[model samples]
Target: MRISTFEYFTSGVSTMNNQQASLSNLYAEISSGKSLQTAADNPLGAAQAVALTAQAANLAQYSTNQSSALTSLQQEDSTLTSVTNVMQSIQSLVVNAGNGTLNDTDRSALATQLQGYRSTLMTLANTTDANGNYIFAGFQGGSKPFNDNASGVGATYAGGPGQRQVQISDTRTINVADPGSAIFQSVSSNESSPVSSGSAANTGSGTIGPVSVTNSNDPANSSTYTITFGTTTTGTPPTTSTVSSYSVTALDPATGTTTTVTPPTPYTAGDNITLGSQTVAISGTPASGDTFTVAPANTGNVSDTDIFTTLDSLVNALKQPADSTSSLATLQNALTTAGTKISNTYNNVLTTQTAVGGREQEVTATQTAMQTTSTQTASNLSDLVSVNLPAAISQYEMTQTSLQAAQQAFAQIQKMSLFNYLSS
Candidate 1:
């Protein structure tokens, strides 16, 4: 079809304008190094990039959480290690105190050394993190977990029961620290042993020795028993004789029932007396009305599991003069109790330390997995939006050439007309 000059000229100009616009867009893409600067460029790719970017943000946050969790766990593990060392020293001292050769003065010096270790242990228990938060304070990170009690013997836990946790991944959460009560104030029931004591009010030289388990399955292991000393008199006044005897009264904790061993058993120094599942030896002549006790130390019993209190009591006992058989028995009992409690405390600390290590491993694993996913996410996001420099430069060069040719041809055509042809 025949076309007017005006229409042809307008069409030619429009084609050049379209070429310029395409060149400008390619330049922008190359300059910005992003192929999908706007959703209009590639709707699907832009949407995918958005999703990937959000995922990357979440991954970053999770990485931060993992770092924080690792820091806290590391701090706890280190502090617990120090605590275990202190406990080991204390255990050694307890064993040394039990040596028969050490005099009261030497024992007192050892007690002083134990006090130093206790102070060290207290410091370790109140350890703080990089942020100055108490590591063993459970959820009460801002509060100190343990402090000396009124008697300056043991410590009181001031923290909460629930441990602090951190989310390391989308589906995984980990404990950053253990509660002070769990670590320092509790012992496993299966690991606990009965504690024995002579009545503080006893007027006799009679003292109870360390308890030994005669039957592991006996229910009396968990029972409380009291040994009462009595006297039996017989014959005429001029030739009258008296024999010392003892009666066993047991209190069943589960049933809350009290049972007395039928008839009084004769009292003998250094003889083993069976009380339920356990046997305890009594040494030194017990006078009438003297009594001793054996009580179960169940799990979570602070009286038995508190390492600080055990140490404090042992220190006090060691400082006392063992001038009599009763005093010596008392000192030996303290040593036995302290040694057992220290061992239990050491085990508990190890268990807690293992848990912290596990958490650290979990966090490290999660971080590795997240790093892999993050790399993939970044690659996908980059592929969807990033410009390929070599390919973009090639296309840009071609477009520039095409646009220049179009403008040159338009200029040459504009010069062509009937009047110019006639003049030539």
Candidate 2:
């Protein structure tokens, strides 16, 4: 079979051109460090790399979210710890206030200390994170959670009821704040006189206190009641006087009206007084004309009955002089009731603190998972697009050698002079 010289030379040239193209491609891959620079090189691998890139980007975003959640949770936990510490100090004061020997002046001083603690508590409750978002404001991050009036005797929660959460992962979200309402406003108050007192000129060492509510009756239990003692002379010589009878008066808190009920059959000291769906057990002796009053206890959610309310009531009760037994009794009784409520409020704070701890744990776990996912995603993306450097260099050397051989053979073919052969 006769082959044309032109065809032979053209075939050699085409062969070298293909070799050169292959060698250039290997160099490009080595320099670029990407086996699949474009979809045309390896369409399926390039497509897979794109998908992996998006997944990795999402994972990175989730990691950022996890970091933010952790910061907020840490801030919240730290403030809650401060709150707990303040509450512990207040508990000690509550115990000391219950002592019967404390004078009105001594109790007032303790109340002043309590007020300082309240100020500190307000600061903690209104704490903000690194972003300056209020930690206890729930979703109202920009608003202060607790606001105290100028006198600092009372405070109100200004934030929302629900907290905000961040998505740390595709399947998980974590709470970033705890609301003040749940931590500070959810406590119930004790049944005692926020304003207990005795008749100013009474001669007996008797006192009256807030009525402790034994049976809770919502609307029916709102009246404030008062007790007045009467004395009678006895033992013929009349040297000794006894509290013979006492009348109980009910004053409607809603209306300023009063109803003095007839003395209960035997009106006696150390008897149980029931009014406003609440009860009061008064102990100790009382002189004639001595008086005591009982008022409503706190119910949850009433701004007038929050933890701040308990402290304010204590401060006011302490300021009053417990000069007589009746006055002393009122102070002691109010202190006892406040003690229980303070303990309960502390417990409520602890419950939320526990929840905050749980959220912190979730943040930690989510962060670890996100890190793992990010590593795997990066590996998968590398596998799909990254070039094997050593192997690419070997292929480049082999292609260069083949291209040189093709060029040499094509040059030898070009020298085959068909015109000289025809002359021979």
Clashing pairs in 1: none
Q: Which lDDT tens digits does candidate 1 get at residues 85-146?
A: 88888888888888999998999999899999988988888888878988889899899999
Q: Candidate 1 regions off by >4 Å?
A: 3-7, 203-220, 229-247, 254-256, 260-287, 299-301, 422-424
Supply candidate 2's per-residue lDDT for 240.
60
Question: Model 2: C-alpha RMSD to truth?
Answer: 6.2
- For each candidate, C-alpha RMSD in Å? 3.3, 6.2
Whole-structure CA lDDT of model 2: 0.75
Candidate 2 ranges beyond 4 A from true positions: 150-152, 188-300
Highest TM-score scorer: 1
lDDT of 2 by residue, 1-424 (tens): 9889979988988898898888888889999998896799988888898899999989999988988889888888888889999999999988888876777678889978988998888788888877788888988989988887577566778898997989988888788887888788774333232334454455665545445555664665666667777755455554665436667887776677988754533355567776655666656666666677655544323653478877887888888887865676666666766776677688777878888899899889878877988999999899888889999999999889988888888888887887879988
